[model samples]
Target: MNPVKNMRREDMGLQWLAIGLFCCFVILAGGLWYVQIVSFKKYEKYREVQSYRTVRIPAPRGLIYDRDAQLLADNEPNLNIVVYLDQLREDFTRTYHDLKGDKDLPYLEGLELEKDARYLTVSNMVYEASVIIGKPSALVRSEFESHYYRHRYMAMPVLTGLSREQMARFMEQGSRLKGFDLEVRSKRRYPNGSLAAHLLGYMRPRQRTSNEEAATLQMSFDYELPDFMGKYGLEGQYEDELSGEPGAKSILVNNMIYRQEEEEWLPLLPGKHLYLTLDTDIQKAAEDALRYLNPNQQRRGAIVVMDCNNGDVLALASAPTFDPNIFTGFLPASVFKPMIDPKGSLPLFNRATYGRYHPGSIFKIMIGLAGLESRIIDPEVEFFGQGYFPMRGRRIDDTAGAGYFNFERAFYKSSNAYFIHYGLKLGPETIVDYGNQIFLGKETGLLPAQETGGYFPSKQTVRKGWHPGDTANLSIGQGKIDVTPLQMAVMTSAVANGGTVFWPRIVAGWESMMPNGASVFEPEPEGRIRGRLRASPQSIEILQKAMLADVENRNGSGSICRIPGYLIGGKTGTAETSFKNSNGRRIKHTWF
Candidate 1:
């Protein structure tokens, strides 16, 4: 009897368990159905009502200044006329309804008509604002449509870089206009105009943010504030460092796409200041000597001056230059066209770092270094020059001809046969060894993306097509080689600074621009040795004495550079590019 009672109790327990499972399944299904079908539209409406539109606002680019706190490239306040599209939604709706009254149109056609209405409203608003400022403005239909369809949630740029008079008039009378407001954005300005244009570089308008930043925000931007991207020189090279992190703002909109509120989602981090090693006085003076003092004021040439102690670029001047300030605004065809013309002298081209031409006799510095370091050169020993270096039955003409020359006489005179004679004794391997040692076939690590290493014979190339003629040309800085002015400066510097070859440094340091008129500088290391020439102090003194004579002596090749105040030490170079001026005049590349 007890066994039968236990069985009945077990059966009741199983039945209760089955009933509980059935109830749980029913509740789960009911909840699923309620959420998927019943409350779907309600929650969807709420999601749409709380929509967020992200717009990226780029931080101001870092200010660029010389080592002495003289501003080379900086930002000035630019008054831009902009209109908040969200604030104009009411105007758009009213205009659309008025335009579509009593008209039955297809869905697509109606969308097109609504677009037209929006454009008309914006155009009218811009026109009214322009009337107050007494300035005429044009609102192209296509441009207006593109902005509306692509970025309706963002502020539309109407007019940029306005004059003070126009800005004052707008504030006085046109502030009452709906949706139109003046925004003050940082506009790049060079106080000295074209001064240091090549080094400081230029900026072009490009509204964008990096993919990494966009991913970090976990949002797609609907619009971005207009920002400038550096095109060349210091501005372009350190773009990432100079371009501070962009800020973000979210536009909260209602279900009807009306902007309800706005909030700054991220604080704007201002860009750092790039302190350069340029001396304004020397830079200006160099420019004046190159351009204003020259017989032909519009000469296409480049000049480079470096501090031998640290490879600091003191002055880098390129003639036939344009103003950097011209790039940030409406660049007329008249100004920008000539700079980019293939047949014309391209002022935008940085001749100092990028242009490649035969190094000429300036390369003799390396030849001399090679000879002295290899113990084959005696500064006191003399050699006879036959006016030219003969190789492969071919004669390479020399400026210093038919003279008995020693290391000092030949160097100051730039005697090709004498240097070539010694350079041959050292062999191509020894010379190439020394050339590559000074990073001759490589960039000086000066500008970011702006330097060519110039052409030097690599170990592989020198090993293979090994010709005595090539070595002869290498001695005189003429054949199968080219260099820029910056490279020459580094070469000259090495000789002056006792063969401690350095990586040229243009940007000295960088520090973030603080808000409270303070800065924290992170100084970059000075005199970073890229390679060593392995030359002794006596060899260096010999070269210095020769270079000094080249300037100080009357018959020396570089005698023109000799002035009373400065004891200049230099080598003379004449590169035969066979390049003629646009006017068909013979303009020489007399490298000094």
Candidate 2:
């Protein structure tokens, strides 16, 4: 009983000590809560510093169309691959540590080495991508370096324009392998190849302009990627209206890559369609005729067929054209650029409204009109024709050889002497007045960029050192008087339509998008008023008869222009371009 009591006293003391230990554990837990609850944000920030991601969102481009609602330029599905730089940092550090290979390396001791290690991280990623995609690749070192140095948040593009097979392989193998992604992008397509190349135009590599783009990040486009903009023609002029606004997306990104978590922004807008006055069938026809005449080589020629009723240019053809599609990609030396050089021929030159040539015998029509109005010459007045007329000591030759001629005979024959005699009688001042009275020597203002202001020698221009020779030259459609085929067509149209001159138009109407699909807007006619010719019906009748005879009469110079069942009025010309060439030799350039 005494031994038991002594043991119990010590055991009782040990039991009390165990109870105090339990209470101390509770106190330690409460202290832990006090510190952790207050400092949780700091620890969360530390974790975020270890792993966070950023991604980029690409905006969708606008659609392009032809006048008839044909899709000329549209986006095709393109698969793009990009890599996130931030996610690889941890792996890079681990790789760096392994590469050091048991060397005694203090943390943060090698600053330049760390930079190299960072580069190696990206390089390894590229190597892995190359191996997975079966493509030879490495970091475009300078580009990578620059991008990382400038914008660390931006996702780097490893590859673009991936094929369907490649994209499938990427998704199946590359995406699962990590740090690589698949994205659908839009690529521009031209469905008709080279049709309407000059008119539809082509695009160049351009960044998204701030005014055209919706978001701010979109404007920070750091690369000069291939994109197209209309360079010339109607395409260049109406680019803005045709190129609709670009839409944006706010991409939700985790620190890993361009994950495309959510497209939290605006939708894309499609472009409007354009309608032109050009009839594809007629344009093709006109082009065929020019080619048929000179099939061996490209001849410097133009054709303009207009609807005399309204100023609609049914067809305007020019030789030496290019397919607009080629301009969108890499332009070869064989195309539109060569002609622009000073030494090059510029065969693709639009000559319908642009080429200014001496009117030649065609001007005799205007001269005949003026003479009939002046009453200096009558249709019945027979003048004894000589092969050449002596004028101011210079002899002017007639296209027709010597014969007795009335106005109608002279007109049908295109006698230079007869017209010269009448043209001089009208005086250079009246002729100049008539030239100016019509829109000659000025722009027709149809397409200013594609047109020229034809020249007419004014009295002021003539009197400055005026010579009777100059007047004589003017009499036969030579000297400082030049006109475009378009101008001639206008004159002919005026004669056909009772003397109302017109401004030529190419666009008939435009198509717009309705809620369902597409809708077309109508076209309005364009033209101007030139002075009305107060012609005697007899005079007009005589001139019309001569013009018809010029085409219908087998002996007439313009016999080739005669079309069966169609009473055609016509004139033909062959003119010389120069008096001399190199090597001190006399030469001449001719057009038939």
Candidate 3:
């Protein structure tokens, strides 16, 4: 045989083997490269789905301050012991034995009793927590399960509203605890609980925001953080300024359950401080006056005080008001029944700016101006009113005994018959002309959706088959006329300020944090000149003198509203409401 040819064959076989090995290596290397680099993002995304969770740490809510820099609504620190469900994975698996069994375990387990075997595993952890934190572990098991299923990323609040001592104890022992963390969150608190409930309003739970980013962010549903939304009053009217933009926080929670660190994506902006036109001292005085006026507190009424010169609402008070703090969610329903339900009463109702009533004699002021300007009635001329006027075969009586009356005497006595006769002479056209010019029958157009527009019959409205009877009814503020206390205040203000009607200002301004970490704020007010009285200044002087006589004269009806040092000119109103009596018979609801 040829030894040289055999050696050549062996060498050729070795070469072929080496080539096959090289090809295998190349295939393996390509697969490793795809898994490690080319498709790395896809695999990493899958791992994140199972292992990583992004948590939303709520930004501290903005604070509310008054004009004097006094805190109206502020935030308080709330200590809560929270558990990350992602950390309880192994324990939950061990306890259930079968993840599928978790669905049925809740039904079989007795939620009230701590002795049930089904709850033993979860209870063991809870009981240990109770011993360490000094709280009862006999909580409803359903709460823990619901939190686990619904909100896995949000920290599970186990112990709520803990004291400072308890928080300190947990923080000290947190190193040994596997899944427990002490969370510091802000809660809304009003230092003066009921002081300005109506003006300041109360905080409510976070509303469902439509923003896609808001849904991506997370917060505990079980426990309330101070994400208060204004429900009524100025808080609601100026909600955007009071509820400044919420800041963003990223909580880095590791696999072990403890929060590793936290960073602010956007630093929390403090809510803009509001400086109101309301004078706190004057507000207190008005409130005291209202309570004093109705010592029994049985009368449902309201009082409003304003700056006639500047259009600033100094104070506004309503009867049967509730503490706005109660609306914040600490009290049970039972405690709030009488106030919330009120049976036939409405404690939460803001009667001052919201309640609509007949202006009574207050309407006479506008009527007098209308008649005097239209030349239908002369202020100097005398009318013989025999305490009543016969209209459409029905006689209407005057509260003030009528006689030969000049304009000044008629206004002082509030002679309904005289005003009614003259009002009819001017007709609904002139009356409504003046009324609409004064912006009556419409809102003052200040804060949107707050005050009523107050109604008055228009000429166009009356021309559409309207009756003379309707004009007779409206001559003395009856039939279709309805006015809010704010409307009355504004009406009176126009008269006091010589015919320039201004919007009533409530909320002052907003306080907010700037990009440079400095606080920025501005004033907000609604001001406008609605109209000028078309009457001669002599007519105004005649009415003004009569109004003064109504307050200062011995026979004046407005003596009750007078202050010793200040000249207060006001008119009284006694309205009739539709209500049922004790005998199941209908009767008039009286208002003073």
Top lDDT hit? 1
Q: Estimate candidate 3's RMSD in Å.
A: 5.6
The better-scoring model by TM-score among 1 and 3 is: 1
Kindly list the per-residue Cα lDDT of model 3 for residues 320-347, writing each as its tens digit: 5667776666767777676657565676
> What TM-score, over all chains together, does every model reach?
0.85, 0.75, 0.82
Clashes of 3: 3
TM-score of 3: 0.82
Q: Which stretches of candidate 2 lie over 4 Å from their true place?
A: 1-140, 143-196, 207-226, 249-268, 332-337, 462-464, 514-522, 526-541, 579-592
Q: lDDT of model 1 at residue 438?
A: 74
State each candidate's clash count: 1, 14, 3
lDDT tens per residue, model 1, 1-592: 6999999999999999999999999999999999989999998867778678887888988888998989888889999788888788788889999999998999999998888898999999888887888778978889887876666666777877788999998889976888888989888889999888998888988756558766876766877877888888888888878888788899887765556678997888888988999999999988887786565666778999999988899999988788888888878888778788988778888889988888888888888877876779987788988898777788888778897998889988889889889988988888878777777778877874877877887778888978888888788887888888998888888888888888888878988767787879999999888877788888778778888999999989989889999898898888766667679975567788
Model 2 has an lDDT value of 0.67
- Which candidate do you rate higher for TM-score, 1 or 2? 1
Instruction: Supply the TM-score for candidate 1.
Output: 0.85
Clashing residue pairs in candidate 1 are 442-453
